[model samples]
Target: DLDDPARVLRSNPETYFKSPEEMYRLFPGREEAVERTLEIAEKCALILQDTGVHLPGFPIPELYRNADEYLERLVMEGLRERIPGAGEDVFTRAHYELDVIKRMKFSGYFLVVWDIVHAAKERGIPVGPGRGSAAGSLVCYALGITSINPMENGLLFERLLNPERVSMPDIDVDFCDERRQEVIEYVIDKYGKDNVCQIITFGRMAARAVVRDVGRVLKIPYGDVDKLAKMIPGPGVTLSKALSTVPELKERYEQDPNVRKLIDLSLSLEGLARHASTHAAGIVITPTRLLDHVPLYRTNKGEVTTQYEMKILEEIGILKIDILGLKTLSHVDKTLRLVAEHEGIDIAMEEIPLDDPKTFELLQKGQTIAVFQLESAGMRDLLKKIAPTTFGDVTAVNALYRPGPLGSDMVSDFIERKHGRKRISYEHPKLEPILRETYGVILYQEQVMQIANDLAGFTLGQADILRRAMGKKKAAVMEKQRERFIEGAVGNGIPKKKARTIFDLMAFFSGYGFNKSHSAAYAMVSMQTAYLKAHHPQAFMAAALTSDMSDTNRLVVLIDECRSLGIVLHAPDINSGGVEFGLSNGEITYGLAAIKNVGVQAVRSIVERREEGGPFKSLFDLCDRIDLRLVNRRVIENLIQSGALDSLPGNRAQKMATLERILTEAQKRQGARDRGQTFLDLLGSAGVSGEIPLEDVPEWDESLRLHKEKESLGFY
Candidate 1:
């Protein structure tokens, strides 16, 4: 109120530039054309002076040329402000690139990436060290935003961002696989719910799913259907190629008339959307409310879902931030808890060793079962072969073993580095430190940016433009850049032919380059989980299995791991087993919630009654205490079959046989309790008199008892 607030924006009347159209609109008069052109050229001069480059080509890049001259001038001035030592021409490309960024007002876009990621680190969340071309950013590296320093690594910023091609900077953050979601929730909270959402992705009907579904719908015999399906490789095999790959399926297709029809239908539907799922981590947060920009819906589970998939959302100008859940963070958290309680060191997880010899030994030996993402059999083989000796090796394996990198010539280069079969080379003297770790191969997007800047007369800012174009793979933009790069190299006195060859190499690596920042982040998690599996095997496995109690194979593998570690496990005892798999006195108490045919309501009734009274004294006592309506004889028989009722002295079969007598006694006892006839009911059996009297059946043999327990308990 004290100030003329409106004048702050309106009082810029001291001869600033405006376009002819803009001037006509702002102060429309035919007489003002000469004055407006004068103002515009002066503004353009000021912009060019900031870049210190004589504007030679009529068009440099889109950001370089004519605009509302004042807008162009303001953007150029903003570029000067961003990069302090702006050169006349070389840094002019950078200044021009900065102008593109300024025109787009993407300073805040980069800032948002830093803010959310640093917030996660402040909360002790393990974000990746650096990933992709975002690592090529000196601003990012300086801010600890990206771990790989572009200067040291020779990563090119142009490979990350090119004014030649205007696009959003994509920085993917990696947290421990286990803890990725906590950061996602924080984003939803920071940006309002309406402005933040995870993207949706469709699952295409692949080979195995197609066969199983089609077989079911056709009502084909399951044995024949499954046999045909099994003959086709279930994982990664496509329906188009399955018949070609499997002889048995081919035989069925050629010989069986009905089978051919089923196959035909399955192939038609094979690549259709079988289901919808959230993108693993692609979340777009917007400055304005997102729903105003894109529609929203609730998934079946009631989570807020985005209408746009990853590519479509970006096309509409929404930013996608990947909030990946790293299971390693959860593992590390669980390990730390176990250590604090049991080991008494109270070791904070972050304080644990990154260079522990034992941990590396465990990884080198391929003993990384239940160790984050590296638990896969293939990665385990790589770990053993590489025999990683340091954190660098861990990160290298994380980056290099991925599908793209593994498929390329780089895998051989990486293998040579491990074995010293090929000597590491930086090509030019300056690239030594940049490529030293991965044996002179630029393994990341940052390395691409640094290369353009250091060797090819590109400023860090211009190099970012190059990075963007390469990542986008805009053919025309890359072609122009390729010429520009060769010109710069030849002008710098390098041979054009060699520059072309190097350019070719850069293009190849750019295609499959991973982000070092993200790889480091995930590698840290992989290390943490490996550390836990190495140290506190029992507690870690207990928590891991508890998270996946519904999965039978997971339960069995975890149990086996527990046994290998010398941790004892009790059978699923009805009296002691609670709803969750938990550690009790260094032994795992099996979760009764995992038993077949025994529903949660029944488990809840049994558990609540046991907690209220002492433990169940016998079958009769258990049936008497809980509601039998929920806990039917089938449920009771399941409990007995699972050895959950073994807390009582009699064999499982005996316990099962007595279920009839027990239910009869239980109904009478319930009546006595309901009618307040407890004292007389026990002494004279009056309450029990009216109940349908049932007798106990004969007990089963021990082998049969154990076998029955295995069936219900999933002990196999």
Candidate 2:
């Protein structure tokens, strides 16, 4: 009955396994069939053995012996450009990281990442400083794969790649979201297309969603289903847990047979894979054809994808790169371009001063409406409390504003210490240097590793393993790590009790310890956006609006931000507005393509005609010059209603009244031109005369004009 629904419904009522004799007679071959299925499973089961890492070859010149040498040469040259007077410390750190990378045969991995990042930079795509532990590597800084300097930031290379542990060093790259696919295509061309495929991810039905789905399938009322689903409490709460925790759910399950059946079915369906989709940022590039190692399937849009998820691909030794499309990068790229075009000054991202007082001043005021990673309501509130003054403060706040730290007293403690409301003290005097920048609060994973190395006699690599163990909270492993830490500290002449206290503190804080490298990288992006917003409000807001043109809600917010910044927004003008929101005479002009019912082709035609022939003189001039097929009547109507043609000789009401006649005249002229008529012939044509007269009409009322504008622009 549990296995077969058909048998459960079809069995005779009185004789349905009522006794042992009836059960024996019901399914005579059930035991034999089960045995046969087990035999088939045993025969079909295939064991997958671990294979070594497979990375795509870097296209190095034949003069270079290996990728390691090529990587070294690139690093030396990049270092000379990035930091002309970089000293022995930088060289020592770079050489150490290169040794670890070469020993692990990951030199090609670094080269691959560096190549992609360099290509992006050369093509004017904004790449992030870095992400994750990759920012901890000085090699990444030297090779220009990451912009953050590990030596200056005190980031640990072992935290990124530990020689003590044999694991893949994950170096994820962030590119401008608008042009992320272009980078992917560049990579595909460098590596064979068939060798590269995106990874597939599956989504499962959680407890609440499963309950709703099962209830609907059983024809339950939506109100009742929704109430029951809400009763499940928090995320990851199972059906069994909810039934035990909630008295009402328990009562329903015990009293109502229908409720019991529904709950049972939902429990069965919960946590099962509901659908498969592409992983947002994971793409794998194999050394050979991808299909030979993993099966490939086509997405709905016909993009090839691998059957295995990220973890499976990693376990099988395939290199998976996370090419994340970050919208903040797009914002930065657009803002820089607009600044150069409008202000005639090219701003190099790396050359922008990190310690700019104006940027921190904006952050202090919590004026980060569209700033990257720091614009959330909670983060804004936290920022107002912290009143950040330095770049380090910005990075610390970024790390401390996350869920775990915010849920605890860590955020309050950090803020209080930063404002001098609370005394900042370390567990030991030796910890002062490591915790000084963060106000003695263990806000980063790098600090934990540093503490273990400084106070306890542990290598950075061993300290990394301890951090991982504490994060996982595995009881047996944590206990062993705790003993090792204590013994190491005691051997270093520290008292056992103090060591244990510090260990306990480290374990507790490690759970909330954010990656410093990631925080620094993201903080740089946040600072850049904040700096642009404070200094170049108009250009920044225009870029921000263009980046979110498809989202109406975000567009509304950005528009409000522009108004708050005292930057006037002009309506789309046929002669001035580009395909995207652009800066015009120190004001932001609305994008013509952003209007409802208006297409890109239409905007392109309008802009092209205006550019080729000079400013559009009148409605007749626009109609005569533009391709009518691309700029049809509906598009023109949207343009007129949206005030894009306001510079023309007529008001919107007059344009609407005479639109059909204009279209007819424009069509006749276009047909004549297409038929190869001479300019004189065109001039003599009836529709191609000097001017087309409009019907007598009054202008639209203000309220009516606003209403029409709202209809076309999605806002008043």
Among the numbered candidates, top TM-score falls to: 2
Off by over 4 Å in 2: 1-4, 7-47, 234-247, 678-690
506-534: candidate 1 lDDT, tens digit per residue? 88788888766556655666777777777
Model 2, position 414, has a per-residue lDDT of: 90
Best by lDDT: 2
lDDT tens digits by residue: candidate 2, 605-701 = 8888888889988887788889988888899888899888999897889889988877787787789889999777766444445567777899989
lDDT of 2: 0.87
Off by over 4 Å in 1: 1-291, 296-307, 319-328, 460-479, 490-498, 597-612, 626-635, 667-707
TM-scores for all candidates: the values are 0.66, 0.91
The lDDT per prediction is 0.70, 0.87
